[model samples]
Target: MHIWDVTNGARFSTYAIRADEGSGIISLNGGAARHVQVGDLIIVAAFASMSEAEAETFKPNLVYVDGSNTITHTNHSIPTQAA
Candidate 1:
């Protein structure tokens, strides 16, 4: 998984997930913690490589959350960005 700091044009970094269910925590550990500050918005994405057959049937899970990190909705596809 990679964490993208969407609010400040910060660089994205790969990270492993930790269990903190319901804690609403999304932290950048170690030295990477400096890359973010409280209240900064971020996008967390996970990617996987699969074969042609698997790709044909795959749909990425997209989770939507509120400011508190509580999931409000979820779907497999994202809407196209508007101008």
Candidate 2:
């Protein structure tokens, strides 16, 4: 997927966005510091347009593309309630 860098005003191929050690912080592509945090989600299109959305429902720590061009969301789990 295409990732637009709002800071640098550039676009790149989004490899992944993983959470840092602490909660509510994510690392992007091994390039810079954690750019996105909890409650933040970015939508990237093929033509290099990025739209930001609030991750109120669920926040995915990591997003990557596989060999089949399918985007994968991992490293995040649903909150469990006390039984």
Highest-scoring model, lDDT: 1
Worst 10 residues of 1 by lDDT: 11-20
lDDT of each: 0.83, 0.48
Structure candidate 2, residue pairs in collision? none
- Tens digit of per-residue lDDT, candidate 1, span 1-30: 777888886776667768677887777788
Report the lDDT of model 2 for residue 78: 46
Highest TM-score among the candidates is held by which one?
1
Give the distance in Å from residue 16's predicted Cα in candidate 1 to where it truly belongs.
2.2
Please write out the lDDT profile of model 2 over residues 35-63, one tens digit for every residue.
Answer: 54333344454333334554455554554
